[model samples]
Target: MTEISDWRKRIERYRFQGSECVKCGARYYPSRIKCIKCGSEEMRDVELPRRGRVVSYTVIYNPPKKFSKYAPYAVALIELVDGTRVLGQLTDVDFDKIRVGMEVEATFRKLYEYGEDGHIVYGTKFRPVVS
Candidate 1:
């Protein structure tokens, strides 16, 4: 990925928000320059809240080839405070303890390795937000 893509995907992992079409009022994820619902190129960037609750989830017993080492991990669809739903991996906790409605917080962590050059990839993940 290019520098901009890396910056957008890595540094901006804390929260996800997209512009709603001022003309039609639609929601978007991963953001886009154009509103898919109304095809309006004019849009704005919105920052979503950091906390959310798990609405649904699944444990990946057999993960992808690259993620096989991290098998039996939990992934969830979380609904943020702003009502935006997103899918992400649950981190730093036992998979069996995860459940629907469990509160989580956005966090950035290492996702994978690129090559022998020590280039690491990082992305956003969710974890139980201790009060």
Candidate 2:
């Protein structure tokens, strides 16, 4: 991503900032300009709940070029505490131990680096919540 676009997305990437529809209370990640459910332009920024459970997941053994370094990593469809589901890479856990309904929490980590300058991109990843 270009520097300008990356800078614009820092909030959502860093803090999981989402948009909530004022009319219907629906929430969306990556923030939306228009509410899909209510079609309302009226929306407000809300920080999504960090805690969630794994709904489903798959292990990527052969990823794209950008993510090839992290191949064989688990990517999960997680349902956050507030019912906002997000897809993120699972970290600091064993692949065999992953299961549906496993609790996880958001964590900021380095995603990747790109460009001639090797700009490091950081974003949220999920880790198994320790008991």
Candidate 3:
């Protein structure tokens, strides 16, 4: 992947930065310039809540080259309090204990080293919110 794009996303990469449609009050992650639901150009930036519930997940026994060391890890689709769902690697909890409906929270951690520049990419991962 291009390191330049990573650098550009640094500001919002470690946070739940998403876009909200002012027209329909719809929200999205991996922020979109236009509202996908309402086709509205009027949108605003919103920081989603850190805590969420796991909607779905899968354990990766085989991971990509960069993430091979972290194999047997869990990636979850988490639904934020505001109902915005996003994918994040689940960490800091036992892999077997990760289940649907489990509460989790956003965490900033090193993702991996990438590109020729060897960028030690840092971004949001998720951990169970011990209730």
Of the candidates shown, which would achieve the greatest TM-score relative to the real structure?
Answer: 2
**Predicted candidate 3 versus true structure: per-residue lDDT over 22-96, tens digit per residue:** 999888878889998989999998887899999999999989888887788889999998888899899998887
Question: Which candidate do you rate higher for lDDT, 2 or 3?
Answer: 2
Q: Give the TM-score of candidate 3.
A: 0.93
TM-score of 1: 0.79
Descending-TM-score candidate ranking? 2, 3, 1
lDDT of 2: 0.91
Given candidate 3, what's the lDDT at residue 106?
Answer: 95
Model 3 lDDT at residue 9:
82
The C-alpha TM-scores of every prediction are 0.79, 0.95, 0.93
Question: Count of backbone clashes for each model?
Answer: 0, 0, 0
Q: List the residue pairs that clash in candidate 1.
A: none
Instruction: Tell me the lDDT of candidate 3.
Output: 0.87
90 Cα displacement, candidate 2 (Å): 0.9
Q: List the residue pairs that clash in candidate 3.
A: none
The C-alpha local distance difference test score for the whole of candidate 1 amounts to 0.76
